[model samples]
Target chain A: MIRIDAADDPRVAAFTRIRERDLTSRDGCFIAEGEVVLTGLLQRSSFLIQAVLLAERHEQRLGAAVQAATAAPVYLAGQQTLDGIAGFPLHRGVLALCRKPEPVSAADLLGTAPADAVVACAFGLSNHDNIGGLFRNAAAFGAHAVLLDGRCGDPFYRKAIRVSAGAALTTPHAVVEDELDLIAGLKSAGFRLLALSPAGRSSLRQVRPAGRVALLLGAEGPGLSDAVMSRAETVRIEMAPGVDSLNVATAAAVALHHLSGRVEA
Target chain B: MIRIDAADDPRVAAFTRIRERDLTSRDGCFIAEGEVVLTGLLQRSSFLIQAVLLAERHEQRLGAAVQAATAAPVYLAGQQTLDGIAGFPLHRGVLALCRKPEPVSAADLLGTAPADAVVACAFGLSNHDNIGGLFRNAAAFGAHAVLLDGRCGDPFYRKAIRVSAGAALTTPHAVVEDELDLIAGLKSAGFRLLALSPAGRSSLRQVRPAGRVALLLGAEGPGLSDAVMSRAETVRIEMAPGVDSLNVATAAAVALHHLSGRVEA
Candidate 1:
């Protein structure tokens, strides 16, 4: 175990940009924290261990992770110094920065995906928490994969990752450059392109189609662009009168629950 | 038109604490903002208008509100001073400190509430944004009222009001001292009390209850207290595989939609 209590350590630079989208532009990349999320990352073996930053008190707990590593530099810092470097208060004393995962191809996602995959097709969502919450909902309801559309923020952003509780790492997703093409692609694969809108003609629960079903959503305000709405099947979630619409993430949860056939009538 | 450019002016104190709670000791007072929400307050005429703070630029736009006679103080401030006092950029410059509405009896709520009213029955939720978001969802989903358990934070907190986009003022809620008693009261009154649980046995969409239904939810972490759950009907939202539970606010939105009967198959 290496112990150093310096806030200006060059090694800790990667953990600093977590609040911003540019997470550690160094060669060694990817950042995740918390025991629950870090366990999943380590179990998946997606990234090579670059360094482990932890408090002096947690040396034993963090040592376990470092001992199993093949090769990487380890830095130990005090609580205040660690907090200074991370730019936020972290509950779990451990943090890991590993190489980013290889980007998945659209074909890879499609080739491996099923016909009736409960999916969230995200478009124009900027809030990291919303994106994270969407993924968390997706994971809870048994979605096959999450497909990202244009104008959406990076899913790997620290805030999004924490809000998602690290499901961003475990859940499968394909980032498509063209939102229209992604919807069309899903439809061609026999997946029902279900768009959630206040003005949708049909209730989300009533629209029962065969095979793969993709729950289409957009940012809170300007929900599903007119073009996207025109291309996909329109569905409204029946709400009590006066209520306008649900948050994109919340709607995703409800849809996932319904699509998963888990709702016990 | 009145314009004062001092951050320390006593008038904007309540507005300044919009996101920060527990800083003031004065009871029976909460904050409200925006033209729609402020207008709704004017229409209800239930609470005292402690003070109305307006931006000089919005003098003509907010003329009608200022013209109303309610006995509350009307204070004006410039943009720079307002920004410094509030500590955050506000979309709308108008703010009002109104008296807390009289607490409603559970009996009255059940009897008068719409048969299909969507009520966000909160238990132990502390986040102002979550509370506000729940109110916003409740309002947007056409919920008739919000029944907050005493353990929950005050909805009149500036952050809560702002998070709800001023919908906090639009909705009606009866704060109860004992949540179990309220849950029982809801049950005895023939209101279906459906508790939101991630491990719920049934999906909300599959719930086919007739007459008055109350969508019951607890705080984000240890959702719906055990006592409340034991007394109320337990139901879950089906979600994608491996995803964690949705955020409290997001969950509320989904549940509100599901209970509103808009997602019926």
Candidate 2:
């Protein structure tokens, strides 16, 4: 472990001005914050851990995780220095810089799936929290993979990773070029496409999961485009009257739980 | 309608420095932002609407909602003035100050629920977003009411109400003194109590909804206290081996959806 006293230390340049880097380009590197996410980076993520920065106070509690990351250089700093490096009051006090994995094709993600696989697909999901929540739900429900359209936010983004409880690092995912490409690819892969929308023709309870199922989720407001919904079997959660819909991520959890196929006891 | 050109205008003081106000005291009045929440305030809430503030541009779009709030005066200002008053960019261009309704007891909320009702109860939920999401799920799944322990965050906070999609205003809710009181009340009301926890003895699918059901939820990490879970029948969502649990709000959504008692097609 190396000690980083100065916030401007060259060895820790990748961790500097984190809030700014979150918005701008990061040169193919992404930041994962908090101990849970850092553990995910060390253990679950397929990507290389570029480095790990932690507050000195957390070293005792997180020493095991740092030791487990044999390949990554561990940098420890005081809370003030760590906050300075992050450009914010990072109460969690653990952060990691990891390399982004090489891009995988959507076909490859679905081609190797098990016959009874469940995969989650998102289109135009701009909110990172929603993206993270989707991944968390997907992981909890034992989804084989996640596929996102080009318009969806990056699940590897800092907040997204934190909100996902590190599921973004562990879950296998591919970003398709667009909704049309995703639909065509899923159909070609022999996956039953189920789109979630308020105007869905089928209630969620009606859709019997058969073979491979690809559940499609859209953004909260505009939802799945008409063109996309027309191609997939649209399903809606029966809701109380006067209410329009559930949050995209919450809805995903409900649908994923049901589709997980746990027979009622 | 009132026209306010100055940011410091006393008539609109309640709407000034909203981000700060969110953290500090509000003198019994809460701020609701965005056009959607404003509509909830004007139409669904039992609380009295004290005033409404809008960017002049939204006047054309939200004029009907403003007009419907017969007892509240509407304040119109330019975008710059509105932003300055808010101490941030108020992109939604709509805000309202509404009086908080008088507090209701857990007994009263439970007493009013129908014999076959499904009510959601939250314990030690300190996060406003989770509280808001719970309310939204309760409303979406046709829950009759929501019961929150004293430790839960105020659902009327600006962000909570927004995150709830304005369900915080429309949904009937009560803050009980503590978890013990809430448990006793639900049992006395002849409601089947189900507590959601990772260590639950019963799987979610096993519990058949019989009559009035009260689903208990706790915070994400610690979850419901052991004492609270002991009194209620513990149920767990079947999950993948490695995952610990779903987000609190997402779990509530799944449980509420199942307990809503929809028949499969």
Candidate 3:
């Protein structure tokens, strides 16, 4: 590992703006922190690695993973300096800079999944943590793909990536520019569009999936706007009467679990 | 609404120590920000109100709720002073001080609910925010109660309460001294004991509730310590083959939504 003593070293500067770098995607890249997440990225299909930053004291903590990397820049910093630079007190000894996976074309993603697969379409969920959590659920429950309609925060945003526990890196997803085109395409593909709502006549359990299913989810409040709701019929989760609905991310998980679990022998 | 100008006013000091409040006792209080959660708390039968703090700038946003508070202290502060005292800039013009509901004794909680009741029993989930999210799901899918076993965090802890959006106020729950006693008690009460597990023979859907059911959940990672696991039969949510598990809170919501719907219908 290359060693550095100054916080301002150009090598560490990119790591310093890790949050902002992922937030704005100025360099079209984001940083992954902690050894597990970094290793996850390293093992995944051909993601571009920009660099690796670690504490000199942590070389043993990350030795195996570092040796596997062929060309990524590897640098060592003092514990205090690394902590000061990463901002979060617990950096877990390793962080990596990787090129953001190019957003998939809506056309390409729609074509590959099975005709009866369950896909999660998230809208207006600007909260990075929620988006990440959604992705984690999407991955765990076997969503064929997750799409972020316009106005949702980038699922690859740094905080979202971390909250997803590195699942965002493995889960196949795309952000499409045209909302209507994407929805129409799903319909053309024979997917039964089910929108999650608190007021549906029937809860999710009653809505059996017939073909490909695209579950449309929106932010917690101002839930799936009327414009979007009008596109797909509203569906409810049979809740015990009189409490507010689940958080968007949590709601997405249940929906994925519900939709996927159906027809599993 | 009574107006005050200083951040140091003792009248609002209870609001100030919010982040540090003791959450162990039934009467210990917590803060609920934003109007939606405040409205949820107002209508639910579970919590007692302790105080209401409002920003003078947003008095118009809370006139109705404040006018209804008969005896609870209503302290008003300027936006700047409110920000200073709150330790974070909060735009939610209204904040409600809510007393923790007296926890239903484990015996009473299990005794009263239907044999099919889907209860979430948390063992040693120490993070307040995760506990808060758990309560939010518990509230959403109609968990009969959230029982904090001996090792769990206080769900009434300030951060937990705030994160739960005040659902802790309306969700019937208790922190029992002994989990084994409750487990034995519930079994005798005819409640099916299902512990969520990554390794299990039965999918959650296949395990029909036999009257009242208590779902035993544990903290994320090192899930359901071996001792607790042995007490209950294992139940797994059928998942994507590669995926091992869902977040505990997410898994709780999935289980509650699926099981509660069966009973609610």
Candidate 4:
């Protein structure tokens, strides 16, 4: 590990103006914070490691991870310097800058799954927190992969990564151009498409899966588009009157747990 | 409706310094923001209304409700004046100050629930977001009431109310002194207490809940305390390998949906 004294050093330049950089910045790399997320980034062979910047105190705990990132530059700084460089308090004191992997196609992600696999798919899900929670639920329920429509937020966003508890790094995911293409791809892959909505014809408790299943979800307010819902068998979670519906991510978790439990059984 | 020009007027003093005054200075009243939450606060007969402060634009849409709150004072102000009074931009352009209802004992809450009812109980759930999500799930799954131990955050907090989609206002809830007393009260009421944990003895799918069931949930990381788990029959949600457990609120949703379905059946 190389010790750095100045926050403005050229080697640590990528870590500056984090919040501002989050929106209008792209250098083919994303920042993963916290030890668990860093560990996730390290485990994945698909993404190339660019560098790791951590506080001096975190060296002993993250020694093994730093050793593994030998090819990438490792910079060590005091908490103040690290915070200054990050444009925010570095409470976790660990960050990894990693190169993005080559984009995978929708066909490629769905084709590799088992015959009875369960996959989580999203449409127009722009909220990072919802996306992150969706990924975490997807991982917990053993979904084969997460399929995202183009309108969905980037799963690799820092908040999404932190909220997913690093599941965004580990889970196999891909973004496709059109929601229709995703539906057609899932259908052709011999999977049953179940669209989740408040007005679905059948209750989730009564669903009897055939073989493979793809759970389709939408954003909080508008829900799934008619074109997409028309392509899939609609299912609803029974809810009390007056309240509109469950939060999108919470709904996704319940649906995933149910479908995955059925598939595993 | 009364129109006021000054931001520091005593009539609108309860709305000032909202973020800072949230913790230390509550005088048996809380601020309810947004149109939906205001609607919820207006609908509840138990909570006494102090006054309603709304932007002039919303005066027409909320005219009927404002008229219904005849006993309480109604104040109108311009968007700038509302923003200045709130110490933040009042985009939703609505706020309500209501008196907290008299504390209800845990026994009273459980006693009022139906014989075959399902209740969501919490211990040490301090996060407002989780608390809000739990209430939403409880409402959606037809839970009779949400029982919170002393350690849980105030469900009536503004962020919690908004996050719950106003479920916090509509659902029957009570904060008790002791977690154990809450559990004991449920048992004596002929309700089966089911503690949710990752290391539970039986998978949730295998359990056929009897008459009344109270689903006990804790915070995300620490989970249910040993004292609570030992006293109740522990049940687990079967998840994929490697991942630890689902978020506490998400777990509550799945369990509540499962038990509510069984109870209804």
Give each prediction's DockQ, rounded to 2 decimals. 0.59, 0.94, 0.79, 0.86
Report the error of model 4 at residue A90, Å: 3.1
Residue-wise lDDT of candidate 3 within B25-108, one digit each (tens)? 424656677776677666663236677788886576564565564456677888888886776786876677776565578778
Please provide, for model 3 over A1-265, each residue's C-alpha lDDT reduced to its tens digit, 9 standing for 90 to 100.
7888877787778888455445455567777777657767777743467888888876765754665654776888888888777765644767777787767876678788787788899878889989989988998888888888778888667678888887888888887666676688778777788989887656787777767899988898888877777889789887766766788888888888888866685
Model 2: CA > 4 A from native: A262-265, B262-265
Worst 10 residues of 4 chain B by lDDT: B40-49
lDDT, candidates in the order shown = 0.74, 0.88, 0.76, 0.86
Which residue segments of model 1 deviate by more than 4 Å? A17-28, A45-49, A62-74, A262-265, B10-22, B34-48, B63-76, B91-94, B114-118, B201-206, B262-265
Ranking by DockQ: 2, 4, 3, 1
Off by over 4 Å in 4: A45-47
lDDT of 1: 0.74
| lDDT for B194 (candidate 3) | 88
lDDT of 1 by residue, B1-265 (tens): 4456787766566767455644564588776777767876776663467778877777665644555656566677777776776776766887777887777776787778776555678888888889988888888777778888878887887778777866787787888778887787787877878888987877676777667888888887788878888877788766544555777888877777666664243
The residue pairs found clashing in candidate 2 are none
Cα distance off (Å), candidate 3, residue B231: 1.8
Ranking under TM-score, best-scoring first? 2, 4, 3, 1
Query: Could you say which candidate leads in DockQ?
Result: 2
Model 4, A1-265: lDDT tens digits are 8888888999999888777888954677888889888876676652466888999998876855767655788889999999999999989999888787777887888889888789999999999999999999999999999999999999889999898999988888999879998898998999999999998988888888768899999999999999999988999998877768988889999988788776447
Candidate 3 or 4, higher lDDT?
4
Fnat for the candidates in order: 0.76, 1.00, 0.89, 0.89
Q: What value does DockQ give for candidate 4?
A: 0.86
Off by over 4 Å in 3: A20-23, B17-27, B44-47
In candidate 2, position B161 carries an lDDT of: 93
